[model samples]
Each structure stands twice: as C-alpha cells, then as structure tokens.
Target: MIDTVALPRPYQNYVYAYPHKTAYRPLTPRPAIADLWSGESTSTLSLYLHIPFCEVRCGFCNLFTRVGAPDGLTGRYLDALTRQAEAVRAALGDTEPVRFANAAFGGGTPTFLEAGELTRLCDIAEHVMGADLRAVPLSVEASPSTATADRLGVLAERGTTRLSLGVQSFIDEEARAAVRPQRRADVEAALGRIRDTDIPVLNIDLIYGIDGQTAASWRLSLDAALAWRPEEIYLYPLYVRPLTGLGRNVDPVAAEHDWDEQRLRRYEEGRDHLLAEGYTQVSMRMFRRLDAPPQGPDDYACQTDGMIGLGCGARSYTSGVHYSFDYAVAPREVRAIIDTYTATTDFTRAAYGRVIDGDEAERRYLLQSLLQADGFSVAEYRGLFGRDPRDGFSTELGSLAERGWLDDAGSDRLRLSPRGLAYSDAMGPEFFSPAVRAAMAAYEHR
Candidate 1:
C-alpha cells in the first residue's frame, strides 16, 4: 500500500472543505425526500446551477462536466434541468420557504450555450428555483471563445453580477503548452466585449506550472490580466490528474521536487504582483480588489448554511449530507452520465453522496475557515460545538503549531502563517477524518 503520510511536496490529495465526489457511493434505496432535507435551514441558502457543456476540454480540467454537447443536446439538458428545479423547489416544501441569498452558474462553461438558451437558463433559476436572479448576486463562468456579444448582453440583462473568464494564460505559447487552444488576440477581444456589458465585477483565472512556463511568461499573463482591473482573480497551480489530457502525457512523480519548487516560486511571484497592484488576498488562490463592492451575500457561510444545486454536475449541501449525481472523469463515461441525467425525471432523492456526521462537520468548519486569510474563530466554533477546536484536533493543531505553520499571536483564532498558506494543499488533507480517507481510497474513478 502507498504511504499517504509521506506524499511529496505540493501534496494535492484533496481540495478539502469537503470530501471529493469520488468518495461518494450510490445511496441504495435512496433517502426519503423529506428526510434528506430534514432540519435544513431555509433562512438563507445559495443556489448553484450547472451547465455541463463546454466548447472544448482543457488539458488540466477534471471537473464533473463534458465537452460540447451535440446539436439539440443543450436544449434537452436545459429541459431536464428545468424538471429538476421544479422537483427540488417542491421538495423544499411550502411550510418554510427557502430564500437564496447568492447564486452561481458553473460547469464546463455556462456560456457555451446559444444566446437564447442562456435566457432560458436564467428563467429556470428565477421562475423554477424561485431564486430571483436580479436580487441575488449571480456569478457566471465563461471562456474567451464563448463570451460572445449576444451572450454577454443576455447575461447582463439577466442580472449576472460577476463574470468569471477562464483565461488560463495570456501568452499564446503558454496557452498551447497548457493544451488550451486560444489566441491572445481572441482573449483580448472577449475581455473587451465583457467590459462592454458593464458587469459589476470581473474575475480572471490564470494557471501556473505548465510545461515551458517561466517567470517572464507568468509576468506577461499577470500584467495582461491586471490591465482589465478585474474585481477578483484566481491563480491556480496546474495539477495533472489521472485521465486528463496533460496527465496522460506527464508523469506526476518524475521531478516532483523540482516541480514543487517551480510552482511555489511562481505562486509567490503572482501573489506578490497582485498584492502590489492593490488586491487583497482572500486565500491562496483568490485575490480581490480592495475598492470593489461586495459581490456575495455577507451572511451565507458554507459550513453552516445549506446549498441547493441543480443539474447533473451540481452538488447540493444540507446540514448532514453533501450529495450530487454520479461523477466521472473519462470522456465517454462523462457523456454517458450526462445522457442519463437528461432523461431523468425523479430529482427528489439523492443518487450518490456521504452523510456528514458531527465530527466531519467540525473538520469541514475548521478546514474551510482556517485556510482563509482571516482564519477560524474560536468563539464561533465554541458557540456551534460547545468545545474548543484544540480539544478535538489537538494533535493536528499542535503539529501545525510546532512546524510554525500557525499564527501564534492570536489566542482567539487559528490562522495559517505565510508558510502554512503556501503548503495549503498538504495542510488541508492532514485534517481529514480517517474514515473519509479510507472511503476515498476505495473509490474507483474512471
């Protein structure tokens, strides 16, 4: 058996905050509709709608979505989404109406659909899901090729507060190295169109650690992204996972030490550059402009509140359960799942997921907040669990403290020092429950 304890630097075991979908198993004789949502608060919730169709697949992407659907498939998928939304809203019941405080549209790419289909997508969120898109902060993900004038116009009219464009790299050669087929000229044009729509906030996503990428190329991409004065930016490290385009060509273990050093240096370079440009680091991956208006609901906390997700790839969260439809990484397997989803009529019960016990919930609460720059609050954790985190996670906390990864200045909170933040990928999984780790190891991913 492989020793997970000694995994190399930049240990990308799991993203943390929640167990990966791979660990989820089929819920045989699925939980009852009422029981699945029992005791779930309706005061405030987040709505996530998935559009699992993209124009093209990126090399490093392992999200539970498929590339461009065939002709008419998009329409059928939207129809299925509408059916799912109706069923879900009904499941929430009339006794206590759930109010959505924030909404997001993610997928392979939500903008891959035609302009008219995009309108229908918004309708499903508003009319079917009862989430007033205009009232809630709505975020939509787009790509250079698909952020057309027509689509941007529709999104703006439908109250999309934020537009997140995936510009992996502004350098043409670097883009090619990442196996993302797009020209710098096209990316600039897409940015221009997005600006024309006057979306309240713009977010640009960039990746580092691609083959042939250097500090100079990284700076070029950062400079180009900064030119837009985006409200938020996400810098992601390239992780070539199994079955991905890049994974097939690269050996993850080969030169692991060298790759880790390169990624760390580039990450620091990007972070420092953004900070100098007047952006505040929210976490290791996210940076936001200090002067920009708030984009999300201030009251919604991922750990405590519930989330309603629609469509095949979206995951829903209640107090005790985190569930979604079947997940896959292989292209053929993904296509089959999407096909099955489009034909489904029953959306009341979860198909696959793990039940979050009290211990798992505490772990999630700590991981999610401690990873943030603001850190986790001892007072709040006490209020929720009636005990100190150090009592339950004493060994883990003590280890992190001994390694100087934790901030020792504050007694009321636990925050990561700069070094801890740099090794976040490793620090996150260290807190996972043993049961979760075993379950994830047994999962068979395609």
Candidate 2:
C-alpha cells in the first residue's frame, strides 16, 4: 500500500493536447518549415484543415472562431489554405513518400461553408496536399443548421467517414441556458439528413452540466441521441471559461462551488448509460458503438506521428516541435488574426510554437496514453525513454496508487481504475511539466 496524498480538483483543466497552445510563444528566429520536416519520417501523417467560422457563437464556447464570416472571407480563407497547403507539401520534399493515415476538417464549423466552398476545401486537401480523402478516415464537425442535404452530400461523396454534430442539448430550454439555440425538431431533422448520407459514422455531442440541469433532464438528452443509434457519442461537461457568454453572465464563485459535484454525477450517469447501450468509452469524452466500423489504423499513435495542419488555428506537430499561428478567442482579435493569415504570402516558416524536449515528450506520451481506456504498454514507454515510467514519475504514480486510482493487477501495463478514469481532467494536469505550466500561466488570455 502507498501513502495517501491530497487529490486536486477533478475539473481543473482539459488535457486535449500536451503543452497547450497557451505555452506557445513567438520563435526568436522563425524556423523554416522545410528544415523542420527535413529527415523526419513521413509515414502515417495526419492532415487537418481548419475553418474558423460559425453561424452563432455558443455562450459557453471560447474556441478560436468568429460568429460569422464577412463577405468573401470564406473564399479568401480557402485561398490562403491552398497557399499554405502548397507550402507544406513542398516542405515535405519529393523523395520521401508522404502517406497520410487520416484527415479531419474542424472549425467553428466546417459545414458552415456552402456546398461549393466545401468542395473546394476538399480539392485543396486532395489536389494541393496530395491526401486522398476517400482513402483516409475524414472526420468533419457540423452544426444542426449547417448539416444541410447539399453539405452532407458533398461530404459523403468526398469520403467523409465521420460527421460530429454539436447538439448540446435536445431540450430547447437547456440549450438556451447553455447559450446554444436550436429546437429538438430541427436537431432530429438534421440527424435524418445525416443518416441519409452514406457517411459510416455519426457522432452526437452532448453536454451534461448547465445552470438548471438535473439527472432526469440529462437522461432525456442521452436518450434522444441514442434514438438515432449514432456510431459514437461525446459527453462534455459544461465549462464556464473566460471570454465566453456564460463566463460573462454567470457568477464564478457560485459556479465553482456547485459545478464539480454536479458534473461528476452527470458524467457517471452518462457513462453507465452508454455502457448499457453497447457503447465503449474511448476517452473521458468519447464513446463508440461496438459495431461501428474501425475508425483508423490501430497502429496510429498521436504521440509519435507528425501532423500537417493548414489554417490559422490548426496546429502542426512534429517530433521536436508543435506549432501554430496566433490564437485568440475575442471576436476582434480572432478576426485580426484571420486577416493576417489571409494576407500572408510567406508560409514557409514557423513563427509561433513551443519546442518538445526529451522530458516534455515523455510527459506527453504518458499523459496521453494514461487517459485512454486501454492504458499504454509499460514496455513501450521503457523502450522509448530507456527507463521505466516509475523512475521518472514515481511521485505521481505513487499518489495515484494510494488513491486506488491505478489497476494493481499487473506490472507490464499501466491502466487507470474506473475511479481514476472519472478523474481524468484532474489527473491530466498533474503531469504538466513545470516549464509548461509556467508558460501557460504567463500567457495572456484575450
């Protein structure tokens, strides 16, 4: 038995990516994009195209997107993406065989673009970037109003394997409370249209915590999503972040006092419900139907592969560095960044990013794997680092074991207990290196 240690708050941060973008700062002398990828393995790369426009900003959202695009802005953005893609493809070099394992279109909402624009976007990915959309698992995010038949048709014809719809709540009242506006009827209609397409997977996004949410209301939303028998589902806890509609309107002290316990209850309820319905939990936020087609190559590990991202908000990751352009949440600042992106002609250098040293990389690998349902193989970590994880992360591992958060059944693999999985948001931050935490702390939130 290990000595007990105090546990941190369960909802402190969402560890979506290691060394969050906030830690990124301007490079002193920008590195040439070509040199960054020089001699790097090009096998199993991921391609991402970001569209940073949405119909209406959600109250609880702080994503780097504006409410709507100005006239001609969409066309200009695509033009810029084409330029960036060309630069990136050239940077990858001609001799090395660059093969993309999967691709994604994410944004304020990719479907917000018109059908013709969507077609052009795919053209850039295929013709300019040399990524065959039909040959890879292409996931795109959509909203109820934007998931029109034409848009869905364009996506289906271009080989979109997955479409994630952001239906925050099936109840209009709850949606309003969460600052999302939509009717259940419209949502169901959108689902019907989505199903009409040959897209193999439909992923519905739902939120569990809101001002007036209760267990009964949470069930309604879950049941409504289940009615469609979506291939996947995501249950996100509502977070009142700075620079968002909810953040501006809600009382912070009250939210802080009330949210954690309430969200935990909702999460457990949702998790158990999905498990009973024959779905498997992929991460803290993702659940997949047992019978859904294989999503991607099982060998693709995000921690080790390189990703090529095009767009102001998309981030590209290489073994030594993760980089992106200027980021902001405020409308004015976001627009300024996008304007700068559209005006950019030189896409050959990385101007803003953080380097991944040996220590940081190990932390990232461990943190990313531990959060998944099937924890990573200890032998794999040992092979990469030339040392056991316990040697480097003994304090953290000990604390987790003391809390009964670790599976003690074996020594060859590192797995989280059910109780530990429930505290993923808390556990993730515990692994943030001191330098990353300091950089993130010093970042100025717009």
Candidate 3:
C-alpha cells in the first residue's frame, strides 16, 4: 500500500483567487473574412465524435455524457452526425475543399457502440470529411472492459492510431470500491489486443486523489503502468463534481487529505518521476513518447482554426467562433444542451477562439506559449504577431525573465524554468482579459 501524505488545511494555497485561467486559442491565424464568407470553409480541421453510452459512470468524471444511453438509436445519431458534417461542407459551398487533418472519437466510451454501428459512424465521417483520415493523427477513447480483439481490430482498420484507455487505477480492490468496474488483467489484455493491431499510441488515463488513495499505492500503480510502456500517459487528479459518484463520496471533514496544494504536490511528484524516465510532458497531465518532438504553435494553431464535432455534447468551431449542440437528444433533455450550443452561437456570432486584434493577439500569444510548456519561441511569436514579443509584452515578459520564470536564447525561443513550470498555468492568464480571468478566478473560490 502507498503511504498517504496528509496536510493541514491552511497550507493549501487557499487563495481568495487562484488568478490563472484562460480559454483555448489557436496558434495560427485563420483565413476567415466576414465579407465573402457563406459557409464553413477551412482546409485544416479535426474531427471528434462522441459516443454517449457507458457501462457505468466513474466516480470522478465530468464530461458531457450519459450512462446506459440508448444504443438502439445510434444509427439515427450517425445520420444526424453525417447531416451535420454535410451541413458543414455545404456551408463552405462547393468551391472549397474540406479536409480533415486530424480526427478523434471520445465518449462515454467510443467502443460503447456495436461493431457495425462504429464502422458506419467512421465511414460516413470519412465520406463527408472528403479526405483520407490516415494522413493525420487519429484517436479514440475506450474503457478497459468494452475493448475486445474485434472492436480494436475495427478501430485500427478505421484509422485509429491512438487508444486512450480509461485505466483510472490498477488496484482492483480500490477500483471496485469506487463503484467503477475495472479489472487489472482486463486493462492489460485490452492494451495487448490494441497493440496487436496498427494503433501506435497507447495512452493510459490514471486518476489520483481518490478518497482512499495514498502516494505509495499511486506510485505502485504508476510502476505497473510504466511496465506496460504505453506511448503516452495522462494523469488526472480525482475531483468531485455534482452528479458524480465522487460527489456522493466526498466528505470534507471526514476525508483525510483534501487540500488542493497537497493534491497538486502529489501530481508534481508523479510528473517529475515520469520525466525522469524519459517521458516528455506534453499537454497538462499528458506525458508522451520521448521521441515525439514537442508540438509547437503550428499544431495548436491548426486544431484551433476550424473543426467539426458530432454526437451528444460535442462542440464545433467555425472561424474562431464556437457552437456546441451535440446532445443525446433524449426526449426530455434534448433542449438542455441544444439551447446552450445553438442559441448561444446564433446570438453571439462570436467567441474567444483567438486573439483577433493585434494587441490582444500578442498578449494571448505569449500567454499560450508559456502556458503550454513555460516556453515560447521568440522567432515564431515575431512571425505571427509581426512584432517582437519581447517588445509586445515588454513589461510582463521582462518581469518574468527577471524572476527566472522566463528564459530566452537571445530571441530565438523562451521556456519556463523548473520553478516556473510550477505556476505557469495559473500565472499566464493573470494578464488575460479581466472577464476571462475573473471567470477562472471564480473556480478557485468555488
């Protein structure tokens, strides 16, 4: 068993405000003009289809989803999704060629669908996307139990290069205790089956900070995870949210370790250990193959530019604006997610997709680069912003550099120091728009 680290409540940076929060932004500029725009038109795009059914809901999970969602209606959902894709293509008109540069299938568990239904979903998407999906990174999320040789074979055949298996924990005892059904052996077998196919990347999702979790136990699990040598590892600390089993399990007073800082420390320790083993930390909580060169502004730019989304609770972006209407369409909750995604996009005709104005663009540009890896390429920033970022964010950049959080190679690139990585996410957004900052600040208060 792992030893649990207990902390006093006061040490938790119980700040009245955490002071770091920002929205997603694409790194590259989109060629969108309001004048001649008639329909969706973008060359580089990503695809994300949601599978809303799950065998059972995990204790600490919060994504737009449903459990025991009707699987019989999957065919209809596929039809609606294809219509949505076609609508996207038609909106862009017949002149522009729509291309899918990247694609991902998320879910309750994408494998929740039967084999044939899954294949049809991908087939229609490929037809509407108008391009070979193999040319780009493709991913699908699956739980341990639902994965089988047949299902994995289908996924691999359909261009899924990455598999993010939901292996929240390897401790079968605790796993069963959490009301989440998982078998240690099953997770291993799923990985084996997927590996036998063409999927190159196997990402395991590890959840820490469960009610009865300890560092030793978590580390032991990490050792077990590392033994599998997955191409990527995503570590998510357990969090309690409304409507989740964790919410019911959470007892502030009764819980032994609940301080935010302590939770964060545990994460940092895991991160450092993983890095020691030659895994490169990519996105937040995501460590990937050491050989996978860091994704630069270019990758983030393409993803943020324009993409189509489908299934219940998915979001799509067009020309820097976001619209999310993918709801399960349950006769009762149909209006819930629909009203939010459709009505909001229609009314606002806007979103914080990118920093549009030159000045705001510069601020966010620095913020994003730093937030990603506590590093920003000075040259790239100059090329995009049309001005030196050091000059653009002269004061903040200089202050951070002076504080040792920022590093520069005489203007080629900038990266955060080891200490800087600790506060990069929260600190980057302090300079963001007040509204955005305030909204994120509210999270800490909660």
Per-residue lDDT tens digits for candidate 2, residues 376-406, read 8999999999999988999988888888888
Q: Evaluated with lDDT, which candidate comes out highest? A: 2
Q: What TM-score does prediction 1 earn?
A: 0.96
Give the TM-score of each candidate: 0.96, 0.98, 0.77
* lDDT tens readout by residue for model 1, 1-446: 22233433765753644877877889887985567887778879999999998888899888877877776999999999999998888888877878998899999899998999999999999988888888779999999999999999999998999999999899898888788999999999999999999689999999999888999999999999999999999999998888988889986568688888899999999999999999998888999999998765547888789998888998888888889899999999999999999999887788998889999888888888988988988999999999998999899887777666787635997898887787788888888889888988887779
Error of 1 at 90 (Å): 0.5
- Lowest lDDT sum, 10 consecutive residues, model 3, at 12-21
Give per-residue lDDT, candidate 3, residue 269: 79
| Backbone clash total, candidate 3 | 8
Order the candidate numbers by TM-score, best to worst.
2, 1, 3
Which candidate has the highest TM-score of all?
2
Q: Once model 2 is optimally superposed onto the true structure by TM-score, how far is the C-alpha of residue 326 displaced, in angstroms?
A: 0.6
lDDT per residue for candidate 3 within 1-446, as digits (tens), equals 11232212322221111122123333334333232234545666677777666777777665555565453455655666666656555555556666667788887788887788788777866777564656667788998888888888888887777888988888987687666887888888887787788787888888766656678888888888898788899877666654556666666565444445666676787888899988987645678868753221224253225656665456565543444433232323543543343323222122223333445445545665665663666777767768876676677666566556654536577776564555454455445656555554444211
The alpha-carbon lDDT assigned to residue 350 of candidate 1 equals 86
Error of 3 at 169 (Å): 1.2
